[model samples]
Structures are given as C-alpha cells and as structure tokens.
Target: MNSRITSEIFEATAEPDPEAGLFLNVATNGLAVLDRLGLRERIVDKGHRSPHLIMWSSTGKRLGTVPNGPARDPERGSVVVRRGILHHVLRDAVREAGIPVTFGARLDRIEQADAAVRAFFADGRTADGDLLVGADGVGSPTRRHIDADAPSPAYSGLVGLGGVARVPGLAPTPEAQHMVFGRRSFFGYLVRHDGEVYWFANVTHPAADRDALRAVTAEEWLAVLRELHADDPYPVPEILRHAAGELGGYPIDDLVHVPHWSRGRVVAVGDAVHATSPSAGQGASLALEDAITLARCLRDAPDHATAFAEYQRLRQPRVEAVVGYARAINRQKRVTRSRLGIAIRDAMLPMFLRKAADDTRNDWLYNHEIAWQGSPVGGRR
Candidate 1:
C-alpha cells in the first residue's frame, strides 16, 4: 500500500526488501500488485526480527513445515506480510531515502495559516510546509494541538492477545484461518517467505480496566491469557504452553466520531482521524492509504484549501464505513450464551467479506493515483 502510494508522488525509494519482513497472505496480495506495476522488486530474506540484520539462510529446508492456512488462497498467489516485517522494511527504506526521517522527536506546536503549516518540535526547531499531514497514531499530538476537542478514541470493550508460535509439524492447511468461537475469536495466518505462524485472539469480556490491565505482573498476564484461550480450538493450549513471557495486553479503542479531520493548513489521517478496531485488520492499510491520498489531494487541488477539502471528500466516507464495520465486528466478539445469535452472525461473514473486498475495489479509493511530476506538493493533474 505504501509502495503504491509513494510511487504516485516520488520515485521508487529502493527495490522492496521482501526478505526484511514476512510476506504471505492478503498482505502479499497488495504487495504483489505494486511489484507487478514495476514499482519494486520483491526481495527474499530482507533480515527482519531485530536491528542486527540477521539473514535466514536455512529457510529452504524449513519451508515445508510452514502451516499454510485457509486465510490464504494459494490460487490467489498473494504475498503474505507480517506487521513487524513491514514496519522494519518500510522504516529502513524510508531512512535510506534521505527524506529526513525522524524518530522519538516530539512536536510541540503547530501554526497554520495562508495555506502553509509550521510544526515546531521540542528541539526548538521548526519545519515549515506548504501542507502538513498528521500521520500520527491514535493519541495524535497533531490532532490535539489542532483541535483539542476533536473526537477521541474510546475503548471498544475488548482486549487482544497476540504472539508467534512455532509448533513443528502442526502446520495449517491453506494460507490463513480465522475462528470465532462464541463471542471470543482467533485469527491465524502463515507469513510467506519468512516462514512463521502468527496469530491473534480477541477477548471481549472483562473489558480490561486499563490501569488493572497494566498493573498485572508478567506471570499474572500469562495466566490471564491462558484463561482467555482455554476453550479455543486445537493447539491453543499447546501454543500457550510454549508462550514466551513476551506477552502484553492493551484495551482496544475506536473513534466514535470526528467532526473535523482537517482544519486550516493542518490535516489528520488514519488512526489520528478514525482509529478502527484491529478486528477489521484495515488499520495500517487505511493509514497507508491516507498518506498517499493526502499527497495526491494536495498535489491535485488548485490550492491548499481545495486540497484539504478534496482530502476529506475522498476519505471521510471510506473511513466512516470502516469504523462502523469495526464496531459491528466487535459486537460479534462479545458473544455470551447466544447460540442462535452466533449462528446468525456466522451466516453474515461471507457477505461482510464480500463487501469489504468491494470497498477496496471501489474507484474512489484503490484506483486513485497521482502523477509523479512536479514538487511533492504542487504536482496536480
């Protein structure tokens, strides 16, 4: 997604480091689209997992043991991607681009007027821009500084536990698998290329009290995870048995509403504007979409004001739809003693999946692109 969007505004930064991350499943599908467009070359073993640049020379022999699950369609031949792998790959590529990337830097203030934005950082220096995009995460400093009263993300009454498990001969058939048992749920998929099985489960009960959730000792946290997955499908127990104490927990939250996503010269995108639940799996994809769309809008509009409007015009409906869908999915995960309800809910998934695929295929999105000429901000048309 980032590759597709970035190519529209800038030259290919570097051939995509496919080996730097896990590539398999739906994520690879999107990546393959970019690769086929000649924007990148898929690399093998790009060296992820740490900053140490370790390569997986033993991948070939261990490849057969990989669990290809239902979530992936071998027929589609899409790339499987891991969240961490994408982050590391994109982070390294961005740094190598000489595009002035910064980490751990804090923004202190934002001043915007006359179609320009100046962001002041804690270092007592400021970066001025013809356009400013708040690609920050859910607790966006830009959103707060720009609109203190803008809608905030609220806990969606759920918590998620995620981890990677290595169970030697227990590979799943197909590519990826999602199992919703009662109100709780589990989603597992094999990341292609990297050869690891990653899974996440949603627990909607007990709506973790943030303070209590964080207060638990490491041992207590593991106990809680085991308790949550006790009734889940095969190997969930075994997966817990080998679980690394790396376990962590956080309350899930979503933006119920946001009156304004852009104001004056400052505009917000992604989680900063509409943070949806992970149950939707569109959070990162949506954010990447925002970055590219914002660039395109600013490039195509007659001026900053027009571009801002165009940005909202193109994104609002799509974000709202996802937010609504996310909330609805959350409702399903909260099931309790509702057998009839579960049956009906299960019946709706196929329809929901179809709609989601259609949403991505819509012309207003996925198909939108901007030419790679002119300044990053002035390349309209």
Candidate 2:
C-alpha cells in the first residue's frame, strides 16, 4: 500500500496483479488510509481480525492477549499476503506509473556536478538525473557516497530464522500473531485459514561471521532450533521439525543512528538510511511512507536542495523513534535466553501487555498521517 498514493498512481495502478491474485492475510498498522483511497477492495479480510496478539510460554500455557491498543491498533487496518506478492503489487504500481525497474546494475562509484548527478556502475553502465534516490537497502552505496562517515548497521545480538509450512489440520488464527517465549530463545508462528503457517524464531547467541552462517545447513540449524524449543510449546519444535524450503538465519541488525539521510543531490530512503528490527512491523510501512513523502517534497519544493532537506528533516525523527521502539521489542523477544530472565519476563508480561492496551493515548508511532498533496508535516524541528 502506498498509504496515500497520489491521484496519478492510484489511477495508473487500478489493478495490481499481486493484490488481485494472492489470498493470504497479513495484519498491519495502516489500512484505513488505503481504505479512504478507495483501495479497500484490495484488502481481503477473509477471517483475519485486527489488533490481536497471542503469546505462549515455553510449556504451552497461554500467557495473555492484548485485545486492542494504542500501540497495536490502527484505524481499521491490517492487510495480509505473501510479501513477495506484495512486492509484485508495488512493482505493478511503479510499472503502471511508467517507471522501469532495472536489475544487475551494481553501483561502482558516484560522480556529481553542479547541474546533474551521475552514477557509474560496475557493469560499465551509467545513469544520470537531477537527483538520485538510493533505496538499495541496508548496504546502500548511495548512503556511503552521500556521507562517507555514515554509521554501519548495529547488530542486535540476535539471530533470526523464518519459514512457511503447510499443514491441513492447522487452523487459521486470523490476524493474531502467535509468539512463543521459549526458555532459551523466542519462537513465533501464526496459522492462516488455509492451514499455512508462517513462522519465525530468534536466538540470542553469540554473533558469528557471515561465512559461519553460510556454513550451517538448514538441517543443522533446525536441529539447534529443536533443542532451543525442545522443552517449549507444542508447535514450537514441531514447526521447526516441519520446516520447509530454505531455512536461513542472519544477525538482527539495525541502523540506530544514521549520520546523514540526505546530502546534496543524493537522498536515501527506507532501509538505506533507517533499517529497523522486524519486531515492530513498521519497516515496510515506514519505507512506503518515505516513498510518498519524498515524492511530495520533490513535487512541491522550489528547489532540489529544499526538497532533499525537507525530506530528511521530516523523516529523521520518526525513523529514529521507531528504531528505539523496535530495539525495546527486540530486547523483550531475546530476553528469554536466560532462565532468570525468562522467569521474570513471563511473570511481568501480563503487566506489560496491560499498560500498552490503552487507546486514546495519542500514540504517534502508528497514527501519523501523510499530507499527500501539500507540504510535508512535522518538519518544524
């Protein structure tokens, strides 16, 4: 979802293949704006409910649920589908706008002059434009060229593994995201109505080199997951045992403080400048927000300098706040590494859920709206 796609985008992308094809359900924070944009027909709410969280202890006991909250509840939202398919839908939107997406064009270096910015690629290709938007993800070459001294992504001391499995007996939990706080780590899975289970687990172990991670086979990792959730809940170990297709793990990393989001004619967006842990479910949403906002700034601002400055000024604070919030959530998910910590966490989780359950608290994290056709908002600072 573009959150609030401009009129041109909305008209051009009247029919997106991904949205028209996939039937999977995903719960999110901001579908109301999509609904308001007359795109609500794209959201398929078969049985998935919004604003529901279900956590289980290692031994299979239900901890509790936070029904609806200022933190979890957004205005009539939550859309679900395979993320790859979601990418397709977005790609269709871009294609509809007549923007071509090219692959295999790796950046080798950057060269800019007073009037135009040009990027030289490793493949001996070059592209030039008035401005370059670097959305090349966390390892963005654009970010480096924008500010050579920009900080690297900080590792969060956790490893993440996820896979999807099909079991006909499995019943859909709808929009509820199921999390397991195991004795040694964390495991989470949710059953879709189709009995398809989307699962992910986090292990709080020592950080290893990327080569080390590459050497571990899926079976080897699954064995470790078996041990991690050996004493945990019913499906925790079972899901790992039933893991299908490319089970992989990587260190959870985030860009806590980006020194420069925009410099001169180059501007970075999404994970390029503000990569957040997946715990908060805002990374994709924030990036989508960045896309619309950046477009608005460039369209309305009098000059490229003002547009770049305004984009960074408007987005930096919000992204930083989300980084901190997700870090907090990441700590909670990884806290189960110790026995004492697990006991304390399990005991206090109910209280924690209660405090976050209140609405009308003016929570800005999930409630911020975009001014699509006007100047960007909240840039006074």
Candidate 3:
C-alpha cells in the first residue's frame, strides 16, 4: 500500500518466512481487475511470496502468528510486486488506449447538467463527459462537490516513517513481513531475498502538518527511531543504523465515513470515497476492485444515474466493512502502555488467529469473485 517502499516483486502470502521476516497476508484481491486490463498474469508471474505475519511484544516475545490470508496456496501464496510496476503497467495500458492524460490541471469546481457533467479547472479548461468518474483520491474536490458539508478524514494520532535499507544482518526473505509492538511505537520490516530491507515505524505524534513533518532531518528522526526500538530487539537498532538515506514520514489519516459518493452525474471511487488506512494493506487492492465494479455497473446499467446508484449500493457496504477492519488493526498498531491491556491483547490475538483458520471466516471478503455474466453482484440493471 505504501508508495515509498517500492521494489520488483515479493511474496505477500499466507505463511511467514523465518529467513525473510514477515508482511501482511496480501492476497490477489484485485486480480480480476488487472486481468481486464491484461496485466494480472504478468504481475503475478513476477511476484513472490509474502508468507506470514509474526507479531512480537516490546521485549521481543513471540506473541502469535497468522497466515497472510486464507484459501491461498499454502506452498506459495499471493505474489508481491512493487507499486511502481503496477503504475507503469497501468500507464502503458492507458497509452495503448490512446487516452489523453492532462497533468498539472487543478480541478476547481463541478458544473453539472441534465445530459452531462463538466469539470472546471483553475486554468479555464473544462472536460465535459457523459459521466465523471472521480478517482481523484483523498482530499478530492470531486468528493467535496458531491457534498460540500462532508466531514474531512479523521486523524489517527500517529506519524508513519519508512525507508528502504540494505541491512546485512537481516536475512534475505522477500516472502516474509515482521511486525514488532515496541515500547512506545509500532515497528515493521521485511527484507527481499537480496538483503534489501523495507522497514517502517509508526510513532504517536499529535502533529498533522505535512510540511513541518517533512522538514524533520534523517539524523533527528533516526535518533527518535533509535529510542523507539532501542529496547525491542538486537537488529532493530542495527537496521536503523544502516538505513540508506533520510526517513520519510507522514501523518496517518483515514476516511471512515463519506456523506455522498454521488451527486447528479458525478461519482467517486476508491480513496475518493472510502480511503482505507495503510494498516489494512488493502488500499490498492480495494481501489482496483472498485474501478472494475464501477465500470461493470456503468456498462450493465442503461443510464448514468442508474449506474452511479448501483455502483454506490454495491460498493458502500464492502468498503465500510474493510474500513472497520482496518480501524481495528490500527488500534493494535498504536502505542500501548497498560500492562493489563498489553496482556489481554497478547492473549486474544492468538485466539483470533486460531478462529481465522476457518475457511468461512473471511469468505465475504477474500472470496469475492468478479462475475462477468448473469445478474452479477450488484442491484438490478
């Protein structure tokens, strides 16, 4: 989900790689979408295993283990790829389709009419369309145009910092992602088979200013990171000490609720409506799925209005569920100091993992298959 820790491809699967570390059970949640764009098989073939998610307490005690996801190939699991590669693949597809992409166009307002929707830009340029698919992202003006009164995204009271480093002490295992609940923060890392480690740390910070946070220097942030994981484990400090360059940090935010996804002829998709937090690791996957479903709805429905309604009806429920799941995971990643709380958390996590072993536990989520025929999964066409 993070754009910063980009690389070729790794395994983000249902098992953990002891030699590599750990990562979320990132499955092929949006393979169908990529397939439509003729990019799924190519991306998967280049991907690798991100096997297991291993949790540890601040003192380095093994808390529990969970498969990256269920119904995955136990021997291999989901393939992983760099975010940039996906972008490049999509860009190539767009180029092949001869779609004109206008960069540096600042959207100002939405002018809607009975037959079409026009997006007014600050540069006096306008793009009129039968339907405006607002994939602009979080802080989307299209979303705002849908409902001016909609509340902004909520802050999670945390700052996220990550970097790609060559940590020789870290064993090479691209298939694994490791998470450590530290004394005052959350730390996670996974190394590719080439010994290049992709690592991140989440610290409790009340500030939300992007400019000020970006101004913080590498040495300063490294010192802060050093203290957060100082007492956690052996290689924690070693990894930080060997970082490649400056640490990039950003305020954590999530769109828990959106007042209106569609108004007149404009409809929002992906992070534009329900922006999932990074904790879920489904941000990109969910967005890809949204694009596919929205396109299908529009194709199946006779008119733009019906298409927008059907799209929202089918998607609103699923995105809400995923957002709730991400919130629950976010709480666990936040800094914790209570002894009883920590003990209860440590105990319940394993139990939850055990229950998650049931094939049906995540069926509503991971089991979603894109149907290209029949009534489909949405409302009446």
Candidate 4:
C-alpha cells in the first residue's frame, strides 16, 4: 500500500530547540497508540513522566491531587514532551517507513468522482487517491469540502501563553505537574529533573478580544502574565520573571462538534472533526487514537464509504465525551473574580477530588485501548 502526507509548511521539520515549542501531555492512551506503532519508547525517552496533577489555590493552599493518567498501570503514565520533539519523532518514524511526505502542498479544494478523489493544491499541483483524509487541524478546509456547513471552531474564552525556562533553586516536580488557580489567571508548570520548568498560563478574556490578544507583543504578554500572577503562590511569578526564548500565545479554541466528518471520498480526522480545550490534556492523545482507529477501519472495512461511516460512528462519541470533560475543566480554570465563588470552589474542591479519586472516574479516558483485530460491524450508509 502507498501513503502520502501533504503539509502546508515549506519544509517538513521540527523546531530545533528542545524547549522552544508548546508542551504536550501525552496520556497513557496516546502512548499506547505510539506503542502499537512501535514508537512509544522514543517518545518516552524525550519526555518527562507526568502521572499526577497537584492543584493549588492562589493562597498557597494545596487543593487536591488528581491522577493524570490511568491508575491501573502506574509505571506507564502520561508523558509531557515538547510539541516539536514529538513531531520530530513521528516525522522520522514516517520517513523510516518510506511514506512520501509532500511539504508545501496546501489544499485548495477537493474534486471527487464516482471512483476516486483528487486533491487540488494551491501550488497548481494535484494528487489522486482512493480517499482523502483531512488531518488539517481545527481550521480544516477539507471539513468544508466534506460539508460546507461544518461548524467553525469556537473560542474557549481563554487566552493561553506558555514557555520553557530554567529557574535555578526550584525543586523538581517528579511525576507531577503543579496547577495554581491564581486570582486573575490559571498557571501550570512542571519542573524536569534538570531544573528546567515548562510553564503555561491561561487568562480569561472575551472571545471578541482574540485579535487584541494576538496583537500584544511577547514581552508585553510576559509583563501581563507577571501582573496577573503577582500575588499568587510561589514559582508562578518566578517562572514568568525568568522566562526567555519564544513565548507562544494563542486564543484557546475547540470544535464541540462538526456535523459532517466525511462526504463522498473525503474524511476528516483529529482536530478537524472534534477539538477539545487544553484543560484535559487529551487533544494530542485523541488525535493519535483517531489515526490508529481510522487506519484499522480502512483496513478491515470492505470499502471506503463503509470505513468512513464506521470510523465516525466509533469515534464521535468518545471524542465528544472527552471534549465535554475538558470543557468542564476549562470552566474551572477561568478567572473567578467573586470571593464567594472562590471560597465555595475551594471548600468544595477537596470533596470533588476525593469522589473522583475513589471512583476512578477517568478510567474510561486514560485506559482506552484500540483493538485492531475485528472488522467494523457497520454497513455503508
């Protein structure tokens, strides 16, 4: 079988600096997919083990501890790695597999016939295939090609900024990430064994203010963050103070649902169909799950249409559930200005955490395993 990957970038390469790009928390479920693909060890080697999330209030009160990955296998928990490193690992794996990757081939439109599909690129090039899978991310044009009425990505009303910094004298947060619900923002950071801190801050804002947020300079954003986290507990302010090198910022967005995942010979996967906020840290993992599932569907199903239908049917519910879960977390991370609300949250959070821990509520998410053996039981729609 022949496979090809088309990317919009001029060159298919990852950021050279290890700590330069966004950090991804790849849950065990995502690691499981990489394990299936024989790349799990490579990813784990490049990342820090993050199995737990320790929550805290602005007043330095430890809120509670939550498991970040499945409790069943404590040894193999989530791994936090730089996005660029993950990309490099996956890209190298693809190259080793001899898959042809065509960089700078931005899709302009899709033309479909009874028997095949053609992707027309902006560079006056075209590629024919039996089916076209759109992994083009949240702003996927292929999604529109499948269904012009597909829902646009909705802003989560939170502005996200993060960077890596080496803060001396900081103790390593082994196997955990610390989350602080600050007075005006949410700050999360994890220190590697080497004392390098990977940190991010989420500031609440109106969706309409995205353009304004984007217009702010990196230095300006850093200043804003310092102010927001000024009165917060230890390390947040310090992390911001020492932050250097490419600080990334964006308005966090998610697609609650896309009505059409596929049309004719075209199908959408990953953020194209279902996008979740960064709160749950499952966005990358869910995309990995989609890749494995879609491959299995196409391999086992008799035809492309059946494969697409089965893939959507199997995946839509799981991804939507995850999105809902992340949305709930996003609500918690939003700035709580009311003292009463803050007090109430702080008072009730321990109980909530206890209940969640007792019941192992997130097992469904982190423990998800893709079984690639059987053919899908759905017929052509």
Question: What are the lDDT figures for the candidates, one per model?
Answer: 0.54, 0.69, 0.70, 0.83
CA lDDT of 91 in candidate 4? 76
In candidate 2, which residue ranges exceed 4 Å CA deviation? 1-50, 67-75, 359-362, 374-381
By lDDT, the candidates rank as 4, 3, 2, 1
RMSD of candidates 1 onward, in order: 9.2, 5.2, 7.7, 3.4
Number of the predicted model whose lDDT against the real structure is largest: 4
lDDT of 1 by residue, 124-154 (tens): 7677776577777788887886688887788
Give me candidate 3's TM-score against the actual structure.
0.85
Residue-level lDDT tens digits of model 4 in 1-381: 213334222221223455545798999889989998999999899899998888888899887778888664557679999898898898788788777677767788899999988888887988887778888888888899998888898888898889989888999999899999898899999999999899999989876465676688899988889998999999888998899766777888998878788998889899989989889999999999988888877777777788888889888888998998999999999877899988888788877776443356687888788876564432111
Which pairs of residues have clashing backbones in candidate 4? none
TM-score of each: 0.71, 0.86, 0.85, 0.92
Name the runs in model 1 displaced over 4 angstroms: 1-80, 113-116, 123-125, 172-174, 182-195, 337-381
Rate residue 303 of model 3 by lDDT. 73
Candidates arranged by TM-score, highest first: 4, 2, 3, 1
Q: How many backbone clashes does candidate 3 have?
A: 20
Per-residue alpha-carbon lDDT of candidate 2 for residues 213-261, written as tens digits (9 for 90 to 100): 8798878888888887888877777777777666668877899788778
RMSD in angstroms between candidate 2 and the native structure over all alpha carbons: 5.2
Residue 184, candidate 4: C-alpha displacement in angstroms: 0.8
